[model samples]
Target: MLSPSPNSIKKAFSRVALVGKYQADGMQEHLGDLAKLLGQQGCEIFIEASTAAHLSLTAYPTKKIETFAGAIDLAVVLGGDGTMLGIGRQLAGSQVPLVGINMGRLGYMTDIPIQSVQTILPQIIAGEYEADTRTLLAAVVLRNGEEINRSLALNDVVVNRSGISGMVGLAVKVNGSFMYNLRSDGLIISTPTGSTAYALSAGGPILHPRVAGILLAPIAPHSLSNRPIVLPQDIMVSIEVVDGREIIVNFDMQSQTHLQTGDTIQVRQSEKTITLLHPRAHSDYKTLREKLHWNEYPSTF
Candidate 1:
């Protein structure tokens, strides 16, 4: 169902890695079936070590997620967006591209459907696909002007109250200029790739991946006047936890750490990036329409 990009050269993908959702029931059969499919394509299949341990995938070689950078040419993910987000963060700066076989409810990043993998995946491995490069956010937590924690978030960086009953006061600054001071549940600083995630849920505008902008949405701001704003992607945003009962910071909703009141989170564009491979014919609007169920006509109409 997917076609190769006409503009791309025929690249060799002799080594392919398969990462599957280990928590799924009957995942062994799913991974086995896919491994068999890739093996038939004359490819050397490498299973992720963590996945190999969880699933009974001993038939293929295994590689750790931390060191598989150059050994593998391409990675095929068999999970939903959450899995992709985790892998994407880990694979940042690897320069290795990824193709996803969607197995989750909302497959924004993992766009390919499992049912279509049999038909669409082979063409992709054979070097017929479009490469969509997405940027990432690099965040560092500074406690007393000393770096304490650092992480990369492909989706968003959320700083909010830890418990159910409390408000966190935050001071926001963009590019060294004071932006605002607010008391709210927390804040969402998201990349364009993250606009559709928590940013959208928190009443933030959806920024297209191509847009070089970062979205800032306050969670339950005490003042209704506090509105979401989009910032230049290149600007460095510094948010300091002023006052709150308990504050926590999250990277891509995957890794999180508790923070002190004086902690300042500095977020900037990461030098590392992620490359997602899709069919050459893939359209952003089409994915949006299908995934979001847009442009539907009423039965009465």
Candidate 2:
């Protein structure tokens, strides 16, 4: 765990970034309100040029997505997990800290609720929130001995067939040793932070945020013996497309790219880490129980 430097954060913040889903539902109304509230706090607000129309305030400077990190002291992403994923990738190489305000359903990455932003923003700007370092994954797809696309994901990286009907055959290997050729709908390589997302949906275990491990889960495997496994974060994992008519990769549920046969995907823990603002009293296990409704059993107490 990284300790917070009180002196470093006590310094005044001059600029703030507002990231939102431009075309997503209800983005305009919420961003407009956030922009108004942020401006009133005497902070210079910066927004992506594409998201400009969503905000009512016109005085705030708007820059392109690539320029966002260089212009802001903090980034407040308004949307769901997808919104956070997009913003996190942009801020990956930078030291900027992100606070996500959820606007979509099942937001594990964008954990903060929209209704609480107004209440939390003040404390966040005042540096009262605790920051948690979340690891990311880097995935490179090689097709026919050539690099097709390389991307980073905060959640899990998935390789699955595009169509609805058929199952995908994925041959898994770790650090050059053969693991298994899974016959399943898909395979999920998830980080501890992503254990609750697609991995959990595929019958994987929920991992604590501080755990240094990776999850390998077979999505609806044809055989019951093929189950999810957790490995050390330091090991490298490679998934080969064994058999499928067509396959695609889902990076944090943000970007999707097609994969051809004989393609090898190299997965490893990314060097870059995302910093999240967790309120002082927030608990990961508590979140799971609340979100999953796990303790719904009737008891005579």
lDDT of each: 0.88, 0.82
lDDT of 2 by residue, 1-301 (tens): 8765433344345588787877777887787788777765666778777678655546677877677666778888888777787778778878888888887454666677887778777677776787888999999999887899899988889988776648888889999999988998899999998998889989999989889999998988999999899999999999999888778889988788888778899999999998888666767766776689876877763
Residue pairs clashing, model 1: 4-128
Could you tell me the TM-score of candidate 2? 0.88
- Which segments of model 1 are wrong by more than 4 Å? 1-11, 104-106, 299-301
Best by lDDT: 1
Candidate 1 Cα RMSD after full superposition onto the native fold (Å): 4.0
* Tens-digit lDDT track of model 1 for 1-301: 7654432424358788999889987678888898888877777889999999988677889999888789999999999888999999899999889998876464888888888888888889778798999999999999999999999999999999877759999999999999999889999999998988898889999888889988899998999999999988789999999998768999988889899889999999999999999976988888888777885978677
Error of 1 at 104 (Å): 4.7
Candidate 2 clash figure, as a count: 0
